[model samples]
Target: MEFNTKPDVVVIGELNVDIILNQIDAFPEIGKEILAQGMNITLGSSSAIFASNLCTLGSGVAFIGKIGKDSFASVVLESLNSKSVDTSHVIQSETVNTGATIVLNYDQDRAMVTYPGAMEDLRIEDIDFGFLSTARHLHFSSIFLQPGICEHLPELFSKAKSLGLTTSLDPQWDPAEKWEVDLSNLLPALDIFLPNKAEFLLLTGTSSMEEGIAMIKEIAPNLTLVIKDGSNGAYGWNYGKLVHQPAFLNTDVIDCIGAGDSFNAGFIHEFLKGSLLKKCLKTGALTGAVSTTRPGGTGAFDSVEGVSKIAAENFKMTL
Candidate 1:
């Protein structure tokens, strides 16, 4: 069962493109048309962002997901390949079209409509367990978007663990609000679980972050839990102790599009390096802040030097 172990992280999740409409005069109505000052079509998917940015931050990363054999698929491959992420495991399906999100940016907040398309088609059967063993770690995100993987993904996680791969997951917002994945079987297979403040609350059905941490810790006390809060920063619980890392504030922000994914990239990069828990939290927060200084998610992380320069100049810190 020997496999290629060259990659530091292997990300298996959704992939898509984002059609961003900025400076819109008004929200689109049923019968009325609206005008937008600018539009950009970019690689758009939380997992892709994490892989691209993680590679930009100096990690050997690889991606596994489903995309259509269309122009959009080319865009996804180009974006990830340009960042040095191995895309060999990305399955291009001819039966489905690539997924896309229409984002209307309005200052700090925005509205979005996503076509799941091929994202929902990735299943446990589609994954390559041999590929899983090639990486030192495994990270998955956007569980709600992929229905086929949502139920049996534990099989993959368990396989990764049995193959000596550390695992992390970012259960992004579930549109259904059902939060149906059974954590009892899932948490035991995961080493790290990264969720935002709201997602953590909803996932654990708790009113507060502390309450949610308590619930999950009760099941898997040794798991490393990192909950990202927008302005307040990030909180991490590990070895039965809680650690807090305040966010690096970016007063002049273009947009907060892929901030969370950026945070995950930074944290995973540092974690894979065997950095201290608190340092990983700080790096994650700094990278997340760097993401806001630009227009899209991967903008701030174009290069390791670029991100390092921004971290020192804007945040007065080094990555």
Candidate 2:
């Protein structure tokens, strides 16, 4: 189906079923069992959350990803549909299993173990560029984990750029040290690179954020680099200007499973609206802060006005 107008954002990456186990005291020892106070199932994934958050912020969003023809995949599809995100580009695989993650949350901290499953099958052939061509911005997340997608990064980014689409990437760490592609070649193709503190350190092999920023600049001088430091807030280096925004002060932390994704949505929303970089960072911090107060990612705010209220009353971000 064709949209009357192009969507503001198209997210391409992994989609998964997230099983959250809450109120756990600590990690269980091997072969040992523990009980959790609560358990919940949610539709989640880097790209999925980002797309849903963008839609929640009132941007038209389309998601392109792969999911298996399983019950979990059905749940994910239903969740995305309920959120009003377009899922026309999603491919259903008959043989593979839907990717799944088990999230253990204790206090504000969390640990996740993921099984890529069908997410690893997402390839260039699976992508329907027709959907991508109709987007103003493209967000590619969890690239490192999806080996097939990584191989076609240059071509995909190049095509998107030719079509005048802004491209962003949220780099996930390669657990197996299998990052063979030279990021220098890919960095220039991306307009924005959002990496958390640990991922930035691994990507650039830098001891500090300053060094990472400096190193990234040498390769892609014009690219905007945003590094998220949990609790410490976020820092950005754009066009030689440095911007640091503190996290919204939250006394009670519920779950942080999707804080980073919420931040990305907030930043992209403000950026697309032509807001200043500082303002975008503030919005992102507020998005993340409010997300942490909720149980899940997409339920953090019901509307843009909700986010605005959180920004004003909870975050109190200053320009």
Candidate 3:
């Protein structure tokens, strides 16, 4: 497979919209409704959020995902297109509808219910190695949401690596609570493994970060490991050393809906640029904090300039 095109990053995973209910009076009860003060239907899915914000961070990003031929699909496309992300590889499915997440936001906390429709249909066959070769890096997220991708991730990462592209994977919280990824085999092919403290602990089947770190080290000693600890910050490991980057404090957090995904976008954006690991981690924490400043996953990232503005005003840093 060959591709003459050049893109900094190619994101392959689920795509969906987040229907957020913010400032709710109370949590919903069965056969009952709760009135919310604010609401926003924005682009959802960790993969899409990462791709969109990564693009906003000045990366030439492209997305490869499946969506339905419906209005929600239009929202997905329009949202990505608005961010100037390449959507040439996004498939429009006829049978399945576009996936969606109903987000119930309660101040800093959130509960999400996802209906993965077309996203579930994205399989290894749908992935084109030639298309992947067009980019310098491959970042796939929400492995659990895309059962098709989850089933054959090792091969997918291997194929991307064979094409001379660096790769990263963020196995977002598994909805079924079955973190079933074969990390031992998968980590070797994955240049970067971005998982939060909880997800990492579960995936590695350990009680502590040190224990989980030891387990993965046995298989992938050279792997660039990053563990995102919400509020506590992020940690990055390379070789035998570990570096911790504290969370950029956000005093007025609206919600933590896609903070981890935003952190991933920040980390991977710097990573593709060949920045230092510590710098990437710091940027990730800052970006994650920026995500909390707004209502939805992408509110703080309306545009490249918008992200810069948020970074300057809110975080007292430049993007």
Alpha-carbon lDDT, every model: 0.90, 0.84, 0.88
RMSD of each: 2.6, 2.9, 3.0
Number of the top TM-score candidate:
1
TM-score of each: 0.94, 0.89, 0.91
- In angstroms, what RMSD does candidate 1 have relative to the true structure? 2.6
The residue pairs in collision within model 2 are: none
Clashes of 2: 0
For candidate 1, the lDDT comes to 0.90
| Tens-digit lDDT string for candidate 3 (1-319) | 2224578899998998888888999888999977999988878888888888888888888889999999999899999988888888999998999999898978767898889999999999998788788789999898888887786988998999899999998988887897877887789888899999999998998999999998888999879999999899999999889999998789889878689989999998888778999899988998999999997687788877887788899878986
Worst ten-residue run, lDDT, model 1? Answer: 1-10
Model 3: how far residue 189 lies from native, Å: 0.4
**Model 1: residue 160 alpha-carbon error in angstroms:** 0.2
Q: Looking at model 1, how many pairs of residues clash? A: 0
Better of 1 and 3 by lDDT: 1
Ordered list by lDDT, greatest first: 1, 3, 2
Question: Candidate 2 lDDT, tens digit per residue, 120-232?
Answer: 98899887787688788988999766887887897898889888899899987677865555778898888988989898888887798888888888999989888999899
